[model samples]
Target: MKKLSALICIIAILPFSLKAQRTQKPPLHGKHWMAITGKPLAATAGAGIFQKGGNAVDAACAMLAATCTMWDVLSWGGETQALIYNPHTKKVIAINALGVAPSGATPEFFKNKGYNFPPEYGPLAAVTPGTPGGLCLMLARYGSLSLEEVLAPAMEMAAGYPIEAQTANSIERNKKRISQWPYSKKVFLVHQGEKREAPEAGEIFVQKDLLATLQKLVDTEQAALKAGKSREEAIMAACDRFYKGDIAAEIARGCQEQGGLITKEDLANWKPVIEEPLHINYRGIEVYKLQPWTQGPSMLQSLNILEQFDLKSMGYNSPEYIHTVYQAMNLAFADRDFYYGDPAFSPTIPVKGLLSKGYAKERAALIQPGKNLANAAPGNPYPYEDRQQPFQKLLDIREQWVENPGKDKPGSFVPKHDATYHSENKNEMGWATTKDLAVDSLYMDRLWRGTTSIEAADEEGWVVSVTPSGGWVPACIAGNTGVGMSQRMQSFVLDSILDPYNVVAPGKRPRVTLTPSMALKDGLPYLSFAVQGGDTQDQNLLQFFLNMVEFNMTVQQAAEAANFNSNQLWLSLGGTQVKDRQPRPGSLLLNRSTPDATRSSLEKMGYSLQFGDRTSGPINAIYLDRKHGSIWGGSSNNGEDYGIGW
Candidate 1:
C-alpha cells in the first residue's frame, strides 16, 4: 500500500514537471547556464554582460572585446557581418563590415608582376577595415548602454592577464609569421609591464595600446556629445575619429608603407552599408540571409531543397538521413562555387535566378538515389567561365605548390610548395557516410577564410543584423591594438563558391560565404542568428532550420542536439571537393562532454568523434516570446561562449 501510494503521487506530479521543464522562465538564478568557445573567460564575460542588463548586441560587443583580448587566434580589428530581425519594424537588416581593395588595385598589376596581387601577409594586403565602425553603429543605433559602459569590462580585463593556453598555442604555432611583424613582438611576445617574454598560460598578456585606443574613442565621444552634438553627429564624430580622422590616416599610412592597397581614399569612403537582407520562405517560415557576399544564401538554398523531403521519418543521424542531407549540402555547395558573388562586381552572378523557387526545383533534381553526384557539372557553368579566367591559371599551378594540410601540421599556415592535398588527407573525415578513409585519405580546405563576428538588435521597434569578415588575415598586425586586419582580394574562392565557372578577376567582391540569417514565422519575428566556421556554417544552419520548422523542435533543442559537421567545401586547401560515394568534410559532431548514454547512442549512429573545448562558433541567438513577456536567449555551449540578453 505504501509503494502504491508513492507511485500515485509521482504520477500526479509528472505533468507539472514536464510543464516546468518545457516552459521554465529564464535568467533563473543558480541554474547552470552554458556557452562554448575557445576561451572560457571570454565565454564567461559574454554571459556576464547578458546578466548585467545588456541585450544581445551588448553581449556580442562584450564577447568581441573579450575575444580580442583573449583569443588572439582571431578577434577584433578583424571583419564582421550579421543579419538581425526586429519584431517591431517587421523587417530584417544587414550590416556589411567587409573590407575593400585600394583604388590603385587592378588585376593587371599582379599579372604584370607575374605574381598574385597580394602576397600572403604582404604589405599590399590591407583592405578597408570595418569592425570598429560596425560595432559602434550597432551600439549607437540600438544599445541602451554607453560605449564606455559596454567597453568597461574589456578595458579592465585588458589591464592585466596572462596569455591563455589557446592564445599561446596560436602564437607559438604562428611564431614564424609573428616574428616577421615588429608590432606583434612588441605587444604579444614581451610580458606586460616587463621586457621578458610572457610565458604560456597564466602569464599576463596586456594590450596597453588597445586600451589607449579605446580610451581615445571614449574621451573623444564624451567631449563631442558634451559640446551639444546630436546623437547621430556624436556617433559619426566618434566613427570618424576611428576611421577618417587621425586613426584612419595612421592605418592608411601604415598599410601604404607595407605595400598594401588601402589608401586614405579607401578609409574615407569606407562605410558599413545597411542593406536589405535576402529572404526565402521554407515551410511557411520566412528565412533571411545576407546576399551574395557570403555562404548564408547557399544555406537557404539547401534548406529549400530539403523542404521537399520528410526528414523526420528518416530518423535522427541515420545513414540515409545523413546521406540525404549530405547530398543537399553538396548540391548547394556546388552552386555556391559556380554562381555566387558580389552583385555589384560579378556581372555573371545569377543571384535572382539562383534563389528563385523555380531554380531551386531544378537544382534539386540533380541528387540521384543511392549514389554520389561527385564531380558533377555545375548548374549554370557558363556565366562564371569568363570571370574566372585569371584565377584559373593559379588553380592549374596550385597542385604543384600548395602543401597538403594536416592536423599535426595545424601550425603550418598555408602551403608553400606543390603537394597533392586531396591525396594527402590530414583532416578527419567529417561525417560517417564513408568508411575506410583516414585523415590523410581526404583533402584539405584552407582554414584562413571566413574570419567573422555576428551581431543583432531588437530595440525601439528597430532591427539590425550584421556580419563582419574578410578573405585573409594579418594583412598587418597593429602593435598597439594586438589585432590583425584582413587583406581580402576580390578573388576566386568567394566567387567560385557561388558561381563555379565565374572567373576571379580584380576589383570584384568575391561571392561571400559569410551569411547572417534571420527567421520569421506566422507574420512575426521568430529568431535572429548567424553561422560561423566557414563551410560548416551552411551545413549546420540547414540542420537547424529543419529541426525547428520541419521536425517541430524548439529553437534551443534544434541547435544544441546534433553532432554537427560540413562537407560542402572544396577538396583543395580552400574549396570543397566531393568524390563519388565519399563523404564530405568539416563535421561538427556534438560529443558528450561527460561520457554516458548520449555518447553510446551517438557512437551507435556512426559518429567519428574528437573532443573540443566548449567555445564552438557557428551560433548565438535570441527569441522574443511576446506572450511570455520574456526574451529567450541561448548560446551554443558546444564551442564559443555566446549569449542573448534582454
Candidate 2:
C-alpha cells in the first residue's frame, strides 16, 4: 500500500514538471507564414515582406537588411552564410557569400608584422565586404520581390531609427576605437566630447551616408529595369554597381586610406557562390549545413557520433547525458580545429571522410565511459576517404603545437588595450574564471561573440535560415559609402602548423564560425534554425536539435532550454597571441539551474565547470508542422531575439 501511494504521487507530479519546462515562453503559431530573427523590429520587417505577398526568400532578405542596418552585431560589410529549402525542388541550397582576403593578405606579410595570427581589430583585420553582393545575389536569384522592395525597411532604418540601448551602449563603450577612424568618428560620435559620445538609448540615430548609398543602388536598379532589363538583370546591375562601378571605387579608396588592403580589383573579382550543402541522416531526418569552409560540419559530425547511443535512455540534462554530449562535441571540435577549412584552397580538405559514418564510429569508440576526454585529437579521416594522409608529420606534432603554440616564432604582438579591457569586464561578462582555466572575460567575448540569425518560412513551403555576421561595434567605416569593412581576417591563421588549409592567403576565405541549419523530414522542411554565438554556435545548435528530436520538447522549449558549451577547442576569434587561441581542455559551462548531483558527477570526471544563468543560446528557429498544415516559431528568451507568425 505504501509503494502504491508513492508511485501515484510521482505520476501526479510528472505532468506539472513537463508543463513547467515548456512554459518559459509561448510558442508562436502560424497558418500562413512565420518570421523570426534577432530583433522584434527586424521580425516585423520580415512580416511586412510576407504581407506584401513575398516568399520566404524575400522576407529573409528583408530581415537580413534590417538587422544589418540596426547593427545587430553585424553590418552591411559582414559575410552571410545561408541554407535554403526549396519546396519545388525538394532540396536544400547553400549560399557561400563569405568574403576573401585582399591582395596584400598573406602568411609572410602578417609574420613580417610580428603577429602570431591576424590582429583582432582595425583596417588591418579586414576582408573584402561580402554582404552587399551576397544579399543582392540571394534576392536576385531566389526572390520574387524587387531589390528595392526588400531593402525598403533597412533604408528607412538607415535614414534614422531610435537606437536601442544595446547598440547605443556598445558604441559608447568603444568610443575611443571609433574615434580613431575619421569617418567612423564622424558618423558614430554624434555627441562628441559629451559625457557619453554615443547616442543615448532612445535617441534617433541617422546614417545619411548609408541612406544615400542605398538610394544609389536602388536608383541604378531602376535605371536598368527602365532600359528593358529583366528582373534578375536589374538586380545584377545594382550588384555590379556596388562591386565594379563607382560604389566600388569609393569603397576601395576609403579602405586604402584607412590602411585596409581591399583593392578595387578584389571587389570586382569577388562573387558569392551557390553550392550544394553537406548532409547526414539522423534517424529519419536529414540535417544540412554549409561546406567545410564553416564550422557547421562539426555539428553533423557530432550527430553522427551521438547517433550510435540511445540518448533517450540517459534522460534529459542527466549527468550521463551531459557528459556524453560534451565528449562528442570535444571530439568533433578537435577535428574542426585541425581539419576544417576552405576547401576552395589547399591540398583539398577530406570532408567526405570526416562526415563518413565509419569514421564517426571510430571516433565514438574513443570516448571514455567514466571521465572527460580532455585531450581529444583529430582522427585519421584520410583512410576513410581511401587516401593516405599527406600531412602525417603535422598530425603527429599536433599535440606539441597545442601545448606550446608558436614556440619557434620570433616576435610578440600583444595590444595594451586587451589587458585593460579583460581586467575591467572580467566579473561582468558572466563567465567563471579559475587558476586552472586560462579563460578571461576577453576570451568569453570572443567565445560568445554576437551575430544575428534569420529564420523564415511560408505556407507554400519555402524555408530560409541564415547566420550573417562581422563588422560589429567599434568597426572601422570604410569610406563615404558608409559601409564597415569586414574583420574576418582574424579568423585566418598565419602558420600552416596551426591550420594548413586556412593559412592566410590573398583571395582565400577563412574558416568561420557562422552556421545556419535546416533539417528535412519525409522530403519536407522539418526545422529551419540558427543561433548567434561564435564558437558556441554549433554546440548550442546540436543540443537544440536533440532537445526536440529525442526529448520531445516543442520548438520554443528547445530554443529556451539550458545547453552546455565545451571550451575544449581552439578559439575562433580574438586571439592576437598564440596562447589566447589555445583550447581549455575539460572546461565546461553549465546552466546555474543544473542539479547539484550533475555538477558533482561532472567535477568528479575531471571536468572544470563554470555556471551561468543562461548557458545555451538566443537561438531562432522555425518548425514546419506538416501534420497540422501550420508552422511553429521559436525565438529564445536569452536576448533581444523575437518572432512573429500569422
Candidate 3:
C-alpha cells in the first residue's frame, strides 16, 4: 500500500514536471547545463562532453570540432573566434583564432597581377590557419580535458558520420569544383573519382585524411608527453607543431607550389591573441563583441545609436521599429565602411571614438522620422578620440576598393526606396519572394556560402560563444594535406599605402566576417550567442539580443524573430563579395514573419523592403537568467540548429 501510494504520487507530478521542462516557448528551462549548436550531432557531441564533467569550454571545443567535421563550411584548416565570459571574473575575453596574411603577402602582389580584386579561392587566397593553435590554446587554458581527450570525439566523427540534406545539396552543387582535387573530393564525396553522386541524407560521410591530420596533432602531443612534458607543455608543443614545425612547412610548401604567397615564416610568426572586448552599455546591459577587425563593433555602434529609442514602446517589428533600426543600421554601416579594418595593419582604428556615447548621440540626431534620407556618411567622432592625432584625413579607399557595391541598383519588385508609389493599401503592393526581391535588388546571391556558430554553458555560469568560418569552399585543399585551407586573404585590399587603417600588407590580418558576442547584466554574465550569416551576423544577433532583453521573448522566439538583413556594410560573407552592378546590397531585408501590412508601411515610407523566404536566421543562443538561477536555450528553426538542456 505504501509503494502504491508513492508511485501514485510520482505519476501525479508528471504533468507538472513536463510543464517545468517547456515554458513560454522553445527555450527549454533547466537548472544545470545547456548547449545549442548549429547541428544536432554537434550538440550531442557537446552534451556528451558536458555529461562527462566537462565545463563549457570543453564542450564548446567538442561541438566546434564536430561541426567542422560535418559542416562543409568549416575544416581543420579554417579559423575560429570566440568570446568567453567567466562568471567568476566577470570579464569577457575575445579569443582571435583568425589567421594573418603570410609574411610574403603584399597588396602590391595582387595589384601587379593585373587583377582589380584578389582571387576568391585556391592557395593564393590562403592565410596562415589559426584554428588549430587557437583550439589547443583554449583547451590548455580553460578546459579540464586534455587536448587529446576533447578532440577524440571529433576524430571519431571525422572517421565517419552521416551526411545531411543541406550538406549533401551543397556537395552536389559543387561537385565539379570539388572533383578537381583528389583529396577535397575524398573528404566530401566518398569514392574519390568513381561515385560522383551526392551522398544521401543517411549516407555515411568519411574523411580519412582529415581524421589522420587531427590524429597527427594528438600524436605530437603524446610524443611530447612521453618526453616528460606536462599536459600544458604537451598541448603547447602540439600547437607549435602546427604553427612553427612540420605542419607549417607542409602548408607553406603547398602555398608555394600552387603559386600562392604564404611562407613558413608567416606561420611561425603568427600567434592568436586574447584581447579585451569592445563593449557598449545599452539600457543597463553591457554588450560585448569582437574588435574592429571583425564586423563586431558594428553591433556596439548600432546599439549605442539605437539606445536613444524607446524600443519596447515602439513595439517589435513595427514600422517605427523597422525605420528606426534601419536608420541606425545605415549609420553603423557608414561608419564601418569608413573605419573598420585590420587592426594590426592599421594601429589607429578609432575603436574608442566610434563606440563613444556622445558620438552615438551625435549620430542619432542624423535620423529623421518622416523622410528617408540618402546614404549617411561616416560621422566625425574625432571629439571622442583620445589618440595622439584626433583629426586625420579620411582616406577615400571606398572610391577605389569598395567602389563597386552598386548601392544604386533596384532592390525590390514592389517599389524602390525612391518611392513613387501611389497606392497605400496592402493588395496594391505585389508580394514577392526572396528571389523576386532579388530581381530588383542590388545584391546577388553568393552561391551557397555559410559559416558555423556554436555556444555552450554550464551550471557554474561559464559560457562561450564561438563563430567559425573560412571553410575555403568546394575543391581547394591545402598542398598535400587532406584538410582544406581558407581564402581569408581575399578580405584584404590591394592597397599598401594611404589607408593606414586597412591597407593590405605582409603580416597584416584581414578584417574577417567571424564575430562572436556575449552579454552581461547587473555585473553578471548573462548570454552567449552567435550566428552563421556573414555581414548579416551582427544584425541577426542584435535582433536576438533585443528580443530576449527588450520584448521578453523566449530564446527560440527571439532566435526565430523576423531578422533585419542590413546588407549596407562590407559583411565579407565567406570571403566572397557580390561582384556586379544591379539593385545593390543593403536594401532592408525582413524575414517572412513580418506582417504584409508592416512591409507595405515600410514600402510606403520609401524603405525598400526585401523578403526572406523562411522565418529563419542561422543563429543560435544560450541565455542565463542570473536572477532566476535557471538556463534557457534555443536555436534558429533553420533545421540545422539543435538546442539541448539538462
Clashes of each: 83, 0, 7
Question: What TM-score, over all chains together, does every model reach?
Answer: 0.74, 0.92, 0.87
Q: Encode model 3's per-residue lDDT on 1-646: one tens digit a residue.
A: 1221221100011334435533223455666777777777787778778777889999898888887777547777788899988767768888888888776667677778764345666777777787887788887777888778888888897788778877776677677877765556656676444565667777887777677778888999999999999888898898998888777788778667767677888888988888888898888999999988887898899999998889999998888887888788778877776677877667778888899999999999998984565556677676698554332443344344344444433222211111112223332223333334432111111212267788888888789999986754464676656657877776666543223455567777777667888988888877788887656677788888888888987776787666676554443422222331122333677776688798778777766566654434567787888678888776765546676677
What is the overall TM-score of model 2 with all chains considered together?
0.92
Maximum-TM-score candidate: 2
Q: Write the per-residue lDDT of candidate 2 for residues 367-419, one digit (tens) a residue.
A: 88868877798888999989998888997787776655543321111122221
Per-candidate Cα RMSD to the true structure, in Å, reads 9.2, 7.5, 6.5
Error of 2 at 99 (Å): 0.4
Question: In model 3, how large is the Cα lDDT of residue 446?
Answer: 22
Error of 1 at 381 (Å): 10
Q: After superposition, which runs of candidate 3 have C-alpha atoms over 4 Å from their true positions?
A: 1-25, 192-197, 386-435, 438-449, 495-500, 574-586
Residue-by-residue lDDT tens digits, candidate 1, 1-646: 1221221100011334545444222211111122222244554565565455666566566655665555433445555676655444666777676666667665466546554223435444445676777777766765556677667767777777766554454455455565566666566566444433434767776777777777777787888889998665676677788777777776666566555666677778777667777888987888888877766777777876777777889876555566567677777776676556666565456666667776667777886654455444345433333333334444444423222333222211112110112223333433222222222211121221133344333333333344444423232564344456554443333222223433344344444455666778777777655545545666666776676666676555555545445443442123111121122332323322424554444445444343322212435454545565444543443333343332
Worst 10 residues of 1 by lDDT: 411-420
Instruction: Report the Cα lDDT for residue 481, model 3.
Output: 60
Model 3 / residue 4 / CA error / Å: 29
**Would you give me the overall lDDT of model 3?**
0.70
